[model samples]
Target chain A: MARIYNFSAGPSMLPEPVLQQAQQEMLDWRGSGMSVMEMSHRGPHFMAIAEQMKNDLIELLAVPANYRVLFLQAGASAQFAMIPQNILNGKTKACYVNTGAWSTAAIKEAGKYCEVQVAASGESTAFTTIPAYADWRVDPAAAYLHYTSNETIHGVEFNDIPDAGDLPLVCDMSSNILSRRVDIGHYGLIYAGAQKNMGPSGVTVVIVRDDLVGLEAKNTPAVFSYAQQAKADSMLNTPATYNWYLLGLTLQWLKGEGGVVAIEQRNIRKANKLYQAIDDSSLYRNPVDPACRSRMNVPFVLADATLDKAFLEQAEQQGLSTLAGHRSVGGMRASIYNAMPEAGVEALIEFMAEFERTH
Target chain B: MARIYNFSAGPSMLPEPVLQQAQQEMLDWRGSGMSVMEMSHRGPHFMAIAEQMKNDLIELLAVPANYRVLFLQAGASAQFAMIPQNILNGKTKACYVNTGAWSTAAIKEAGKYCEVQVAASGESTAFTTIPAYADWRVDPAAAYLHYTSNETIHGVEFNDIPDAGDLPLVCDMSSNILSRRVDIGHYGLIYAGAQKNMGPSGVTVVIVRDDLVGLEAKNTPAVFSYAQQAKADSMLNTPATYNWYLLGLTLQWLKGEGGVVAIEQRNIRKANKLYQAIDDSSLYRNPVDPACRSRMNVPFVLADATLDKAFLEQAEQQGLSTLAGHRSVGGMRASIYNAMPEAGVEALIEFMAEFERTH
Candidate 1:
């Protein structure tokens, strides 16, 4: 089966092996005489899959023993309200670093339940760079300091982990998670949308320090309450069983490919090659500063915007599909996630060069 | 490929055709050279699927022009909170009819946001029957009157839509939806977890009257807010895309089988045969009142309680799997959803008869 190099931001490309294995097992998962989608969540079979997926995530992230890994349904967008509702504890205030669309969204949602202090912002820079750490107005008495590790729309990333002092650091690592290695112990809570680096769009993987598991704010829905979900093993409701099992396959694939550290190195090489190619080209340009440009989602605009449609159509014909940028930030975004092979990136670079010459 | 009849309560059986279709498209969906899992939710390919799904549902349910259909993520448990947060509007109190576990859960979550008035409850009957409309004590001043149409665990169903007078009737049709025909116009809102008779978990279909769309209580997260979801065409977030696509397949299969009216007839026959078999047996009996017994989930207890383990084991061996009842209410539950062929029901009856006679 010939496949295209998908760069559609998310619900984007998945590991081909994962998809093939899932197809093979779609009719009957592991000789259970039923698809994973057909199993009862409380059944022993589903329980095993759930346990294995959780453990793999723990090992891949090298999650501390004090941290709890949860596979919650819905995307990180749900976490916007859930975070303040769960982690605020007794504090009526929280600090947010507005990096781009994702962080700004969180700040807006948090404003509903608490006093949100804009600790730092890259809005002044047109989201081309991250706000310097020292410029952040840290609220020492706040419940937590939140930021987006990677701004998907703006193509801005924070390579350096900002210190929140004694306060817990909550990070929305949606677009860039599992693409590189990071210290899991540094964050009180970390959430990544599965559609990006993980699996599909059905689940969100949340890794939260055990201390953040309890102490929920009042009137919080049980489904959104971190304490409740952790206690229930993230099975407070029937999960997206098909999505969860498929995620397990991806995690297994990640392990087979020599774990996260090995993948991170490959990712760095791919990102550098694509960025260098774009930098050398007069017909294409990436707006973000080199130091903090996202490795996962690289948004580059054509020198002439009129060529956007032709470029996308030609890319599609070349089996390079879904290269459209997000409407919020009009340009072309190639979300070369972990599933994207380095060959795909090389192909993209070559195609860009050819297209640039013709244009 | 040989398939077994899966009797799981939810995350239950899907039409084999849907599974086969999904498997065929896993590698390359309609020559798009990408799996549905890899499709962009906002792109034409996925948007077409999403659009088809919404239209199919509208046609099948005979949804009124005044009602809006929304596909949202995270299962119906999330809706337990969302419903109260959105529908309570300006009212501080809402009336709820408690028939079983699902209703109880909804009540608990609703209490977090508003005063839940238990208009009627069948807990006194051990949740074996739906409270009669005459016995209801609904508050006339309530924002809406809510009830669970089918109790998954209790094996009780309201065969008739309860009279709520001028008040908007809200129904949680998780188990029984689309298995039977109901007047969509009667409900202000109808939410069902797409697991049982629908498709899979992760996506919850919410059908609400258009007039009820904008009245969200303060601090309602956009993901849960009906107005926001409606405005965004249910793309408030990425949504459970794979789950949504699979649901569309199930809806198509339903149409192929002649829509909800035809399925309701088949469900009625299936339920009758199983109930009759139990009623005729000396060693088995269904606890629910015959009038209120669920057509989808039929729970029965063996006369010899100690034989439960042996019954389950032998049934599994014979390929009648997952007939074990919910943990909350133990025994045997044969959730013969729409996908379960009449032949499977005959096989189950034969197995039950044989098992009972052997003991």
Candidate 2:
């Protein structure tokens, strides 16, 4: 069978070119006589690969000189604990915005280390809309303010970076990091699991401003300390060598596709088409607010829940795989990240239309 | 260049058959129309992969029904902290045996969460020999006994398990797991990083006894909490999905080559041949105690210190790669894990003889 458009929320579709390049280099990487997985993390060959990957990511994101880009493990979930551990800096409280599942999770974890102040919440609106920034009650004395840039499950995203006053702004960009342009200078920290927009699972990218590098709480694991990891260039321990190489390949592929800016344009066009199709149809309706619906994960529900099984079965047959929405919000979700070609989205749209016409 | 014998301490060589299978399935996994990297970790396809991999490991290790095997991230370094955090069980002190570099590192991390009691030390012997078992000062009140079964950097290993009496025994088997048979019933927890004997760098295998599952310290990260992760089947977060698949493939290959009991015999032969060659050569020597020398990583030095660079260069030219010893130790090290074939070791021995004859 030909490669299908995988709509998995994470560990999702990667660029076909990246996969091809990986397969080509599986036995021996670039004449080095060893797979990337076999190279010593500290050896010359792997060091070169690691350096190029970090530099490419910094270049693609236009990250500020004052910030350090770290490739880590344990995903964005680890950062939920690490953010407060490293950046809380002796403060007794942290402010968090509860936009959806991801934010709520972060807030819960932060509560373990410090007093959590829920600055604002979208739960009142069933997580379908981002709470108005003007209405948020952020505590200025808090150590930092954290929020999830894109709520992957609820399909809500913030259109603009929210100001956190004097407190450092932290963002979890797991579902939408490279899909759009953002000034890295706006946040004190930004982290995303590579499984989504980057490459595969295992590696997490953390971009932190220089000032947030130190100040870990006592008893913090060395591997999770941003200060220690950044000092070692994220090689404080044996890293995920093969995953790093795959991530580098993906970034190189992105550059060939004209970097983040160009890719963002494509993402916006693709997202608009899918959302337009959803809005244009009566049978399918997206519950998320029009202004804040996630461009990476577009979730919708059919008017009649009875057709859900048939809709998914037919979509799978059409090679539009994993269209089911999150179990918490049962319907259908089409996660079209940067690697998800526009043709894949079009294919999903056509299938949805045909299904609606028949049912 | 052809695939050479990689002898890096970690992130070492993998079976060619595993790499070949991965390459063959890179674009589409068994007609799933998606790469394994593209599958949802929760979807049926990935769930099947995950199950098979876990079951294979359990079968290969003969893991007792009372043990839970977890596929985790952040490598074994994270386990250093997690072990104490999860199993301290309100005890203030834990006993640790210091054999070499890995044990020293584990002790350092474990100290952050509990009062570390040195049960025995090989440091007095320059980490070349394990201390006498009868001389160990085991504290009955301690929460657990921690020891590194094999040290990659120091080329040392424990010939037999140390009796901790009634205390839960924890072993860091990262560099030598699956190369030998062991009774899982004897351990409270056994953790190994996948880069060496298992598969890749992103995944760490943790086999923990049921009695040691809960009892996490306050504020422990959910992802690192053994009890919570066990309940979630190690899906507490998005795992390193592709890494797990690779590990599964490696395990399957191992099963085909004969399980741990069979691999142990081969490993013994490989290590013995390499050691015999070094002992026979007047130009080369290994400093480790013969009784407890590692079967995985064998660190040796040339009689003439000046020949180090030439030895590495000429070895590389002969397609023998990454033979350089760890930087901390400064010599030559050959890590012949389970995946390393007898032919590769024979090639190395032949090269060693030729190099000795010339220089």
Candidate 3:
């Protein structure tokens, strides 16, 4: 296989060890004579895997005992709709902090279920900075205060977790989950699509405070109800078994690499290295506020407008793939999730420096 | 590795060739140096796979030029809600035939969006047989007539297609899809979960007539809107890529094995062999009516109730697994979808005969 470093936003890189383990077990998982995909969700083999996955996630994230962790299907976008359906409770109003594209989408989906209050926005700075806490106008009676911890598109992140006081604080941690430590008790719900720092795209991790169950509107579909899904152990319907297994392997990989705290240090170092390259060079620039630069996704722009395509093409040739930015926010984005090894980021920086010298 | 045959209802068995290919491609798919799971949905590598999957499904189903094919996440159960949201078209009544567990779920979901009318039912006979078309009470003004072609739980199938004339016909073909060829023009819509006869459980294949588009209720989430999904080529949201690839590979395998027509013949033979064993023995009986006996799922009961646990345990020892029946209907169910080679069925029959002799 050719040497390659994947930098795609998501459905991104996974730990090599996890992939290797999964490959070895593809046909016969743990001598069960069947792939994980071939086992029934209700079967003992799969039940064990499901239980281990839940247990590992709780340990990795330090999720509170009072919070129910759900292994859901649809991606973060699906949670965009689910959050409101489950939490709105006919409150008709919720506070939203728009950091970038994903939070905007969550807000839009939530709009269908409730009146959204824009608590704060960084749109004035082209979504490159987190809105200051002082500017946030949170409604005390709102159902919940929602935010995106890491904006994959804008490369902006919250330096300090927002305070919701007595209100529920919900965070879409899709891109940054497991890359660092978090206080589980601070938020009522934290959801992340598995593709980024977790595992794959099909399974989503939802950590919801136990008291939030049974809060869904009567009109909510059974599939969308947290209470119903939790009751069924995320198996009210068939789940993506292979994906779930792959995620479990990923959790095992995380544990082997000294868990989230250790991985978080590596993530911090990787982010610092890439940001330093951009900061030191006049050829490249990241627009995010230094205090709030995202450690997971780093979106940057070229000093020369014409260098964008050339930079991506040369990067691809050098084995750096998916360096192109999201079209909604054009230039470049390197999503250095937990799976992105330190070497890959260093190589990227080295390549960026060389490219700058040549250009 | 110990040789074992997986008899799961879904997230079920896959072609050995597909599994091998997937394992081989785990690190780099088509030289992209990324597993299909690791690629972005919008990237060239994944786009090609998505388009190819759609085209292969179209060709396999003989889908008409006017019909749209969509690859969606959320299993067949999700479509239960989507069907009504997209096709209801302000129509209050829709006709449904409750053949088994799947159909019952479909009817329940449809009830959420419309006034549902049961056109016919097999409940009177414990869901062992499909009701005759002449017995149907379909509403002429109903937006569509819906039915499940095969019930995974009851081992009942619709041997004959129903004619609805101008009234659109919809079938949840989850368990029996790709098991046989059918005229595409017969139904207005057909959707199947990938786990049974297709590949895995994460993705669903939806074939919608062109005319069915543009009629969705505004309240429907964009993810549920078939029109939106079709327009986006099923990339409106992140899809289950590995499952999609598996389905594509399974489709290729089916075609290589002479397509659904030849497979149907094999399926018929296999179903006959199992049914024949049940018929020849006073020791065992399949409660489903012979005419409606499903070629895919065969639910059978031993005349001696005490033999149930022994049957499952001994069968497992003999390389047969998941012979236990659904909890709702107490009996053994062997879901012998297209992927279950004739040898597997023959082995099952032989085991059943031997067990009967001993017990």
**Top of the candidates by lDDT:** 2
Q: What value of lDDT does candidate 2 attain over all alpha carbons?
A: 0.94
For model 1 chain B, the run of ten residues with the poorest summed lDDT: B1-10
lDDT per model, in order? 0.90, 0.94, 0.88
lDDT of 3 by residue, B1-359 (tens): 67576677876778888889988998888788788888988899988998888788888888889998888877888888888888989889999999988889989878877899999989899897788888889889999999998999898888878988679999999888888778878989999888888887788889999999989987677777888888888878888888888889999899899998999999999999989998999888988888888988888888888889999999999889998988988879888888788889999989988988888
> What DockQ does candidate 2 score?
0.89
Candidate 1 residue lDDT tens string, A64-114: 999988888778998998888888998999999998999999999999989
Return the TM-score for each candidate structure.
0.99, 0.99, 0.98
Model 2 lDDT per residue over A78-99, tens place:
9999999899899999999999
Q: What is the lDDT of residue B211 in candidate 1?
A: 83
- Selected candidate, larger DockQ, 1 vs 2: 2
lDDT of 1 by residue, B1-359 (tens): 36788888988888899999999999999988899999999989999999999999999999989988999887889888898889887889999999999999999999988898999999999998877788899888999999999998999998888889888999999999999989998899999999998898888999999989899977888688999999998988898899989999999999999999999999999999999999999989999998899998999999999999999999988888899988888999999999999988999999999988899
lDDT of 2 at B348: 96
Segments in model 1 whose C-alpha atoms lie over 4 Å from true places? none
Clashing residue pairs for model 2: none
Interface RMSD of 2: 0.7
Candidate 3, residues A140-205, lDDT tens digits: the string is 989999999998888887766788888899999988888888898999999998999878788888
Give the lDDT of residue A19 in candidate 2: 96
Between prediction 1 and prediction 2, the one with superior lDDT is: 2
Docking class of 2: high
